[model samples]
Target: MNKIKKIGIIGAGNMGEALISGFLKSKIFSPQDVYASEIIEKRRKYITDNYHIESFDDTKKLVERSDLIIISVKPHNVKDVLESIRDNITPEKILVSIAAGIKLDFIRKNLPEGIPIIRVMPNIACFVREGMIAICPSDNTPKEKLEAVKEVLSILGRTIILDEKYFDAVTGLVGSGPAYIYLIIEALSDAGVRLGLPRDIAITLSAQTILGAGKMVLEINEHPAKLKDMVVTPGGTTIEGLLEMERGRVRATIIDAVIKATERAKELSKA
Candidate 1:
């Protein structure tokens, strides 16, 4: 395995900060082993004071110094960032990007030929080390580099190595799925509060219920319909509630959201 001595993360936004936190908590890389570049002074100061990592305002300089470079900037600005560091990229360094809509080919063509590139899509849960991250390496990448990428991603939540063809769907189902669940949690908590439960208690119960239910599906490995049948008894309260959900078309709406989001992700790639 190749030793990743130093890692550079461009863009000090939420994703970048989350990656830094996971790296420290997992103890995979020390503060000195990480470097960050942020245009904002406040973000720069936060990383410097909190993690003690070297900070840079120049993206190209950061890429030159680190063995692994993570591009965490917005999709629209990915072109700009790649152009800035295109000349600095070398075959020895690995470039990993978390920007959606920026494909592996774009990164490969914009940078030096044969430079190792890994395109990833990770959610905000990574900050707490429970994130689901997708890793799709460029075809030119060697097995050794792919393994290294997997090791780093394991620090977050579950890491899956997938073909680039499924990236957009992955982005829809997992990447944007959190926000959908968050909305559901909030609505459930609000309903509890309307029934006279304390606000904090309602929120706590709602969150735990969702978490436990999610764990059940994963651990039991049963079809969701079978699980739903187990909960709905003949003329019981669960059946009554489920009937209301069916009447409201909740399932259909949720399914549509994932489909729409997946389509949008595909559209982004085109642009």
Candidate 2:
């Protein structure tokens, strides 16, 4: 029989809850194999009641028992969380952090030298198991542990292993990119409404269109420009809309937004 991996999660916020949901649904880990540390009494009750996993108010106790620990707290709370569990971290354990702007060195400075660490950027889409997760593992992280994380995170859609140097940019493009797509979706829905469609129908059409277009880009494996060309015929309605978008420099503006967000991510780490 295969050995079941024991996992512990620190923090019970949205991201933490998403991971628990993802982990359990994957069936890679069982309820008894998972533990959650939540300071809030209400959240502690919620996790135990809903998921039937062991929930604790003390993070250190959770760290001592689990084989793998996922630090899912916010960026600002990372240092505090690290300090709380650093003494308990063992060489055999793998610590995965989902907090943005917290670097591997920052985590290493707080913990014992050579403690295995993996940093991942997971977006809100993880709640729906359609997230684009970017992972950057430290030199000390074992291959087996990295593979374990990969298998578990597969429940939350596609996962990519990226250079730590590009993490901030990756966070900007995919981590924060969902909000940008949402804006476009809302605008498209508004356009449909302006054309006399009911609000619900407009929203459904706009959302499904984005979903279909995303699938095409992933499945077709053609240059986006080439795909856009396929949609335009001689001189058509699509061309007119494309010209308007170009005139407004919509593409360029979005590109600049990614750069700006990346810069901001770096800025957060400085303080």
Q: Among all windows of ten consecutive residues in candidate 1, which has the lowest summed lDDT? A: 1-10
Model 1, 1-271: lDDT tens per residue? 5468788999988899989888888887889888999989998999899888899988877987898999999888888888988887898889999987779998887887889999999988888898999999998888898898788788888899988999998888888888999999999999999999998999999999998888889899999889889988898999889889999999999999999999999988999
Show where candidate 2 strays beyond 4 Å.
1-4
> Which pairs clash in model 2?
none
lDDT leader: 1
Best by TM-score: 1
Q: Count the backbone clashes (under 3 Å) in each candidate.
A: 0, 0
Query: For model 2, how does the per-residue alpha-carbon lDDT over 43-130 read when each residue is reduced to its tens digit?
Result: 9999999989999998987998788799998789899998899787888888899877889888988898878899999887777788
Against the reference, the lDDT scores of all candidates come to 0.89, 0.86
